[model samples]
Target: MTLALKYAARSDRGLHRSNNEDSVYAGPHLLAIADGMGGHAAGEVASKVVIAALAPLDEDVPGDDLLGKLHEAVVSGNDTIAELVDQDPDLEGMGTTLTAILFGGGRLGLVNIGDSRTYLLRDGQFNQITRDDSFVQSLLDEGRITPEEALTHPQRSLVLRALVGHEVIEPTLQVRETRAGDRYLLCSDGLSDVVGFEKLAETMQIADRQACADKMIELALQGGGPDNVTVIVADVVEEEPQPQATQAFESSNNHMHPVGPTTSPPRPPVQMPPQQPPPHQATMQQPPQQPQKKKKRGRKIAIIVAVSVIFLALIGAGIRYLAYTNYYVGVSDGGEIAIFQGVRGTVLGVGLHRKVEGSCAPAAGPDCRPLRIEDLGATNTTRANEGFPVNDLEAARRTINTWRSEDQQPEPQQPVNCPTPLPGSSATSTPTDVPSLPGETPPGSSTQPSC
Candidate 1:
């Protein structure tokens, strides 16, 4: 069944704001809102210009393609703003907060920058769809301020990124599926500042699209809308009901023992760690050694060798687990970024199963060792990329091949082992102090020759 959208949009010049620096576009399947930002009148001009520039995109396209088009539109709008500012010095620093939604093909494409926001309401729940790019938002993300404090922050309107003073501006884009009975709201900070989520949800639940937009703007005015206000409402309509499992939400599937009907309890929710670890003391005492020092030396060496082999084997197993789980490299314009274990933007990409083993075996060279594979049960795993589903081993292999096609750098057929440092040299097994990703630590591996 085809999914459709019913939407309405409105904008207002708030009580304190002299002019309407906000704009809205509402089509059958397209909805957009922009809140202009500049001390002078140029802000209104910049936002209107962007709205005009993006007025032509088709809303029925795939989410990724819609995102690409929105990105291009933002770039073009940035160029337009830069040219205008160059021509008129008074227009310098003019920018805008943009939040847009294109709903069609049973999906919704979301784009935003600055402080404008998008939200989704479904199943008696509401979720924010856009992350604000503002000083207060960043502070909230870092736990430096509470949500209440952010509402009255001295520099709450200050934006970290916007479409201004440049030839190109990249927007954050997301692709999400939409279903019947789902609702979306797009609004400027002016509305969000005055009308909280609970109130917004209540308004949406009780009113039609036009009434919802009007009521939100009215509430913002009551709270002394110091800035321009804009709001949009979109309702998803599908002819046939679809299963909820295929939506973008994280899965909460319970695990059952392979042999038993259900032996394990449901997994607990993921929780962030505390700031520090609790202290504990060991109670067991070691037995006293009684022997000639020479007699124990050989036994110690044998045990050390066995432990070393076991550690290497564990590392290999971990790598194999990542490989079969559809791990892939996500290359942003910033540089080559890796997405591993469902976390995005790791700096160094680890090739767990490179084909170096096929052409250059370990006998030919140490670097040619075959990649390892491991299968951890489904309960403890997630896909490799941000918003990506986990794939099988065959899919991961194909993805690796695709990455290798663009990576033309020559590889040493044999692994080049780093030589052991001579006596008196500062030596350590850990790699250099490298920075970690959004939610990861630098991998702990030996700098010593693995070959």
Candidate 2:
């Protein structure tokens, strides 16, 4: 019961865009699509970085470790994107949607994040295999919007989760059994956004895999391919007698490796040659060098080390002084309310951090505006960053509450009681205005407090 994957992939820049921002990788066992998102071509860079991360996993892998390897690759991709953003100050806010599938024997492993999609057509039934992490999807799940409404929703493409160079990558991972007739498709919003599910099913029903992909891109263009389109169409087929097989796809700009008909053979991993250490390790491992040279080198090293240590110490002390004296609250690179040693956002691509223990959310009030007007579950990170720095969650809450309270106008206060006279009798009283409370002052009262 051996299984092999036959996949065809295609990417197009579409009518509106001059350059194709979408990237696709198709191999014997792995198929992936990444939709870039950002201005100034940063999105293209992000998508290609992700594809490159997944390029090494094209061969068959262990069924048990497939999910783990996929996770590691995607995590590495996110970290690489973070490092890229760190290197380039202008590439901030770049992100990409990744949807990938790993075929390990008869089981299909899917790792997805953001709004790209993976779909399955089996036994004449059609199903969307991956859930889109989008604002409108949340609305649809809450029964707030209908399927038709989701298509035209203003914020439909506003992805809720994505690999945006964050410290964490939360792609959904799943393993599912496959049958001979099962057909799978991985695509970006460029195709799924335009072609309806029924249209997709009808297009997939086409006999030729390349034609299926080409038709999908065609329909997407007909529906106004406002974004870059990328598609991967793969089918599960029974093992044949042919020991090796390779196919070229006319619709694909990328070439997929020859998926063979023979059972996957276990290949030994490439090993590096054993070698002696170059400098530091060799010095530490070897016994004391010649005593005379050692003493002379050690003395020179000691002086140099001492001077370097002194300089570093002075710089560290200055940094500590500034940290404690001029600390403030701001959102970290990971979008958490954090205390920083310097300014809120990074300056010149260099970041500052002092771990704070809390997450801030919008204060639910009748008068409070919704943080994400179109995105239902999105928290107002800006409002969260407005809070002052505090030690714990409780204090963070208090700080944010205090900030909000200060923002509101003070309520009118009641008039203070003086020694007033009754109907028939008069009581003596000081002819001066009185204060009610620290934060309160009565209307029409002229009371000025010490500055």
Candidate 3:
């Protein structure tokens, strides 16, 4: 089956920011988010330039060439930034984080730099698929801090790498197979930094992509929106075949515009016939002719009514097909996890889906657990209320199994003390020499806790 993306994109200046410094694009073949950094409005310029440079790559590319095209485009963007800096000394420090995905040959080619992120929701699992190129990420990788401590860490925004105009930056790139029901999210650190992963996962579970995007922005704003936020949500789905006639019409008329008075040539004045004397009422009546006219009018009305009915029927059938082909995992009326068929919510107050069966089947596997809403915790319970949409019944089952496995895992340990710095390491240097971690006093300062 042919695969295509159904996607939505959004950006917000945010409650606290004076100006938006983020750029985003979502198209049939590409999705990208860029978060800019600098001063004097240079950040905005950096992001816009990079986005414009990459926008042309939204067209179809051969699957094998996807990564090559993405890499070339990114390097070109970086070069453009360097040129701009040369033209204007004031823009010297401008740069931006880029996270983008190109779709081709039923696969995804992803490119990332800086702290912007890409997350995936496939089958019944959700997780971040890109590692951040930032100092905080480095700290986490080295086991010097826990995920929780990293959030409030003062240098959380200290990016170790990005598309600065000074040099040709190498970005992380990879390709992965795509599935029809997978959902992907690309966003700036503005959203990822403020919104917890649990909230993000729950919001991504929304079946309506547009709604999911909207909720993500709202969550960022609620969390004090310290930076400009941009989000792109895309879903992979089987492409529906279009009638050849419709396709032809669309191709021909897509750019056509209606004639307006300003552009149209002056109409020739209508020639009028000389005024005629009124005919007698009897002659004007034309009784036999009137019957023929009425018959023709009746036939036209009947034809229009028949066509209208047929068109409506076809539309209803298409909607029903879309509603039934998907499935979701949600809490049932009895509060137990259950598998459902069809889309969530309703049309004209009629439910669009029904419970197919309880998610937990004792005989299915040892991992199967009868989970209820009360047991799911706040974030997961919220997800259940919204429903975790999946491609099919099997996907729904996998999601349930994933939840069961997570439930069986142990609790996380508390944050530990920061490790001692190695000789000549940056960690022991003064702030001027190198950035210092949280809870670590710079040289000449009073002693403090090491965590």
Candidate 4:
């Protein structure tokens, strides 16, 4: 399908400006807005040059080809403006903000610089497409001011970047898919800085392209219109068939610009002819048909299979976790007391108060201690009132020490039944003496027990 647009554009001097320095050109596939700056009519000349440079690319540009050609147009406009200023010193430092859009191939390619803006209205919502290259925006970026503060900043009109003099002006370009019923508005700062997005959206919602363009200009004029105001509104529409060659018909004189009442600036209009009689007309009719069943069914099955695989993987993971944490308790012997086999920890709140007995330290090695009581492998205790069972053995020891310090308690006076070689503990022991053959003195010891 060949995509097209119905567009209307206008530029007004406004109440405050001396002569209109803003210029706009828009068509089904071509839309450009430029706001000029400088003294003595130099701004006017620079803007006109930009509009002239971009008017030709509107004919037919593929989506891929749009960015490069649009960039070239900006540079070309800059160079032309620079040459004009060189011929006359009065045109020095003359510059303008240029924003243009080409809509075709079911996409919109945008190129812009300075403070002018382009907005996309889609599904009853409008969004700004370009950022302003101005001092106020710079202040906002630096975090020195809020967006509301910057909006009313006195230096808001001072542009930081623009197409000026002999400098090369390559604009930033953005491309996005265009949809049916989409509407676009391109305008100078005169309209944007004064009129908020909500008000613009309201006007766009109720007005057609021509009415929307006029209303934007009207609002700016009402708001003191401190600068030249310009607006171009374009709406995505289906292209209609063009009729055979016919004579041009002009609109009424009252509708024409006062300066060129007879000259008649061209109207970009497309005329459609009656349904044709040709052998290839069926090919052009766009075949009507019933929907394909196979494609829709295939899509549905793919979604179901993907969802099922994810569900099964989650179920398998849960089963593996339950088998690992359930095992044995404690046991006993003569002098030595063994605790439960495997990692264990004392649960608080056992005796008079709910406080576990034991200080904890992070475990270091086989002899040092394990990080967790579980790392102890297994434990058994001969006496029930021994030290606490801690899943983190070292942590348990530290905790015991902390409690002892806080309570200022002395070591136990009674001989507690601790293991000769403590369970799950590694401590070096002294060598014991043995009698040699009933009569000889021990090899390393001189003293003997009195008879």
Specify the highest-lDDT model's number. 3
**CA RMSD of each candidate after superposition:** 33.3, 18.2, 30.8, 28.0
* TM-score per model over all chains: 0.52, 0.55, 0.54, 0.54
Please provide, for model 3 over 1-451, each residue's C-alpha lDDT reduced to its tens digit, 9 standing for 90 to 100. 5786767766787776656777766655667888888844567667766765665555323457888989998988888778767865656788989999988838989999999999999997999999999999999999999999998899999999999978888999999999989999998998999999888988988898877888898899899988888888888888552110000000010111111111112222121112221210001122343334432332343334324423443454456667888898998999898999998888755567889989676467776557777766666677779998898888888888777666544668777677788887867545466568898866566465545
Where does the lowest 10-residue lDDT sum fall in candidate 2? 277-286
lDDT of 1: 0.59
Clashes of each: 3, 0, 0, 39
Candidate 4, residue 416: how far the Cα is off, in Å: 99
Q: Rate the local accuracy (lDDT) of all candidates.
A: 0.59, 0.65, 0.71, 0.58
Q: How does model 1 score by TM-score? A: 0.52
lDDT of 1 at 283: 12
lDDT of 3: 0.71
* Candidate 4, 1-451: lDDT as tens digits: 4566666766777676556667666544567888888744556666666766665555334457778788887887788777766655556777889888877658778998999999989998889889888899889989999977876889989988888867775677888788878888888998888887778888888556776777887888788878777777777765553211211111111221211111122333321222332210100111224223322332343233323422332332232222222222222232222223232342132111122221222342345321223223232122123444445434444443433344433457664454366686655433357657778765555353311
Model 2 ranges with Cα > 4 A deviation: 60-62, 241-451
Q: In model 3, how large is the Cα lDDT of residue 75?
A: 89
Regions of candidate 3 where Cα sits further than 4 Å from its true position? 241-451
Q: TM-score for candidate 2, please give it.
A: 0.55
Tell me the deviation in Å of residue 434 in model 4: 99
Q: Pick the TM-score winner.
A: 2
